[model samples]
Target: MASVAINMDENSIRGDHIASSMIDSELHECVRQGNIDDFKSRVQTHSAENLVTPCGNTLLHVAVSYGSDKIIAYLTEECPSLITTQNSQKDTVLHLAAREGKDSYAIKSLVESNPSVLRMTNEKGNTPLHDAVIKGKKKLSIFLASTDPEVAYYNNKYGRSPLYLAVEKGNKKGILDDLLKSGASIPIKIEDGDALPKGKSPVHAAIERRDKDILVKIEKEKPELLRLSEKELGNSLHYASSIGFLEGVQFLLQKFQEGAYERDSEGNYPIHLACKSHSVDVVKEYLDKFPYPKEFLNNKGQNILHVAAENGKHRVVRYILAHQKSTLVKPLLNATDKDGNTPLHLAACYGQPLASFLLLLDNRVDRLIVNNKNSTPYDLAAEISRRAEEEYAKTDEMTAVERKQIDSKNSIPADEIKGKEADTNKIGGDYFGVVISLAILYFHACPKKSLFERFPVIKRPRPLRGEEMKSLLGNLLVAAVLVAGVTFAGAIQLPQLRDQRHELNSTSRNSSHENLLYGYLFLDLGALSTSLVAALMLLWATFNYPKFQIPAVVLSTAMVCLAIVMMFGAFFCSVKIALLGSHGGFLAVTIIVVAVMFFLYLASLVFPWIIPLSVNQILLQVVLHYYYYIYFFLFDYSKWWLTHKLYDLKTKFSCY
Candidate 1:
């Protein structure tokens, strides 16, 4: 009997809870359906505050969610206590009304009932004004801001205030204007929650977006914000200058002239950054406004010209040289940094060809100026190139080691390793092996003055300028690179090399076959080495060293010519090897064709030098000397042959 009595009491309490929940759902539904009479009737039976949804929202919150202005007004008037009630998201009725942005009547009812709710923030710390502005509801935002302007400066959990969001969203409506006029303080650090350590400001955003119109408003209303600077991005002008925002830079300069002199945390002035961006107009503007650009050096003691040259801004370099007067230009051209390096040194060390060319074009530029390291511009360029080559060699070796480690981890079979070794040995005997052998032999036997030095056609290197230098050097570099690639490909992938390797390794390895293989390897290695050296010399010429330029062109030209000759010899050798065991008639035919092609190629090279001989008188003497010099360098190697040829040529041309 006791247990039955207890169960009945538990059932009674459960019935009451269910009955109360049904009443609350009906009351909230009446609000959602905009039925004021039904909600009023339901509220008479239960306290409106006690009648709450599962999300802790009162009838007023429900009315706001459905955008029913009449029901909302009725709820605020009758159930005044429900005005400040919040939901699960901590959003008051006003917060919901502001987010809807479509119903101004509902918003005004909520604000007029309890104006303090206008500043009430949700879970994200955003006030009603923040939601209105973020929703782009211009009229609603203006109303909310006017009701309580202090909320405009209330930063949310993300540290973005209403005014910051308005400006950042590029809201051209009266919302931003009203916020500014209401005296909302511009935020100093608007955190974007990004990966960057730096935070940005509203003014920085405007400058970054290049919204000059928005900037103008901020300038007029919040003039103090123009002076604000971030830690990483610097001030408004610094940010604008870095990105080459021309209008922003100009506007900032016109509004805040002091910003041009301010440096970023990295110690770079606005003009220095402008030069880095290659903004010639901005650079000119800075120079025009500021009396002395030379004094505006960065932390590195580098001026605008130094920055421009180091960054390869050639047009800026050119513009500065051409537009500025000699009084200003001379100082800049000759100005040395803290390291004692002039602009020319920076240009050369950074390997900026066009910038180096423009700098060296100026007569006032002191080319002999040395840096703190006691190295001239030419010496620095050489050193930098040497370091680059060494670094490349190190990277190559590291890559090889990594590949070997990966292969070892994979546990390749023993037979595969033996096969790979065979391939390696074959490659060695075919290409690099021949290269090493010939390199050692030639170096050991070479005379102090190379045999080519005895020839008269190989003239001394002379300085070239302007288009002539650009054209000749560019062509030489291209040809050298192409020949190098072809020779490298030929060395590794020739089918005859594999067959030759097989024959050399087998018991039937003929001495004749060995000789032929060596001959092919010699020709291929010669072509590869000469082309590679030619490319190296051409790259050195890009440093714009005058002495190196002419010599680079001359030497690269000779090297390329020699590479072509060796390439042809290698091609013929490959064909001969391929036709080794074939009929004598086929071998004879291949030889004839290759020989004819070789002579034609030679004629093509020799004809150009001879064509200029019959042209003009002044050109005739130069052409004759150059032609014989080239001819002797290419063909006549015997010392006696060179001496007799030079004597005959000198005697014949004595009258001229």
Candidate 2:
């Protein structure tokens, strides 16, 4: 009986140990699979909040890490005190949630379970807000701050508050407001030894963030904060401008009116700041309000214009020129910095031709002012202008000659004449005779020998030598003699011809035929003599002048060809008129033919270089010629076009 009883006791102890192992296995399986329902059921039945798993994560830590919002809710509802529970790393459930930035609902659930969870800090002494701010989780930060304002005011191990984190991350406005309202010290210095000193204030933080609105808020809420100076730097305005916060600049200027004129440790005013920033509007506004003394040099002895020109701010330079009367444009124009470079010298050195042009227009800009390297503005402009002139001169000469030809053609028709009958006859006959003589001279002097025949090339006379002078003088003397003879003969013969014609007409009624014959002879002799002398003078002029020789030859050749064609057409028409007995129609046709030939002759004489070719061929040639021209223009003029575009942008939009 005793042995049987001992057997039953041993069996009972083994059954209890087996039951405990089965329960632990079930909990492990539920945690592994993330089966929230199973885990919650196990926790509800067993209260496993304090239970440590294999890696030392509590049931709460595992729940937070898995982001199981429902598991979290169930555990918090059941336990109601696991909100401050820390895992292996000493991270509370809230700290873990904030660190992962994935458990907002879980965090809210835990917070609702216990509002004091906001004060819970992690192993690194970072509160829930610290993690939230670091992760840029504004929603989480707001939640924690709303739960308890002290959470927002809580500093991390590094002694940076939620406001510092917000400013560092450049978050939206409400986060800082909440922190400030929560008694976060507005003037509190970040305890990080590397941060600005104790009185540095949050305005420095805002300036570091470049947050204009927050800076404005801080300034308005605490105007004394604007006067608050950092340990090393003097004022917020100095730091703001040094960091190039244009909006911060405007705000600081308004808050601290005369204080904006204050220089930083580096002795740079807000104007210098604006110039360095290249903010034209900011510079203009500051210049308009308080004109800095012209002698008030910065540490570098650079006035505002020098700074502006060095930074390539032409608008600022113009503004300084227009507004400040005491500012000497000439002294500033040639003023060199430590590098010994005037504004014009710097502009040219930097390859800013437009800026250089503006500076050079100032008579004060010493054209001969040499830099440290002994280079002058004139040297630069001459180099640039010379390159430009060489490129332009190559293509301009031919265009000028072509335009001159067109103008000459438009002015007068060489063949038109108006006079008495004898004068008209003398003009036409003499013109024709001159044309023939020119053609004969060209054929004799520069004869076109057959292509198959070998001939010595004739050398043109050099103008500087005596050969050309002798020929020209000889021709001029012959022309003078011809003109004198013609004038004397015309003067004497005109009255005689008039008397002879009168006598012929008076005797026609009753006199003999001898008087009529003698009158006709006198008229013919006078006309012939006048035409011969005038023709000789014209020919002499054409033959002597090298300038007129080419055109004369071309015009004479075209006229000869036209005359031949007109004579043939007239003869054929005359024969037809005689057969058909239509003299009026023949006369009209003759006039039309003469007019068309005259126009063709004129065109050939005017533009002898233009070859008569097919229209398509000419168009293709023209297109090919202008294609390269257009390409060259587009390539070379691109800089000017870009400069114009930049000017338009600068004038139209203030930002540019």
TM-score of each: 0.56, 0.41
Query: Per-residue lDDT for 487 in model 2?
Result: 37
Clashes found in each candidate (C-alpha, N, C closer than 3 A): 1, 0
**Per-residue CA lDDT of candidate 2, range 1-656, in tens?**
99999999999999775454333767766765668777766766664655665445666776777776667777777776567777666677787777677645666867886876777676777778888778876667777777776455455666565656776666564666655555333343334433223423467778888888787666555455576556445577767765667788788887887766567656666667677665666776666666543554566666666666545566566555555564644446566655455665445433443344445445555656665556454343323333443434543433567767866766754334221211211221222222222222222222234422212222332233245434544554454444445434534544543343344343442243343334434433443443344345447545576665444433433333333333333333333323232348768678667766765665444343344434333343334435533543365346655775798799789865
User: Model 2 reaches what TM-score against the true structure?
Assistant: 0.41
Q: How accurate is candidate 2 locally (lDDT)?
A: 0.55
lDDT of 1 by residue, 1-656 (tens): 99999999999999887567443556667777888787777678776666667677777777788887788777778778777778889988877777887555756866786888876789998888889888888888888777776667676777677877888888657678888888545442334433112334668878877899989998998887788777868898998988889899889998998988788877799899999887887888787887577788887788889889877787689888886466766678878787788887776666555566567667777766777888666555545544554444544545467867865787978657544421111221122212222222222222234333311242323345466688788898899989999989988865647666564444444555667678888988999999999999988888766777876776688778878878888877777666655558866897869777875777467444434322433343334445543443354334534654796699799978
What residue runs in model 1 are displaced by over 4 Å at the alpha carbon?
1-25, 40-59, 70-92, 102-106, 112-125, 156-160, 185-199, 399-656
Output the number of the lDDT-best candidate.
1
- The alpha-carbon lDDT assigned to residue 325 of candidate 2 equals 60
Give the least accurate 10-residue stretch of model 2, judged by summed lDDT.
419-428
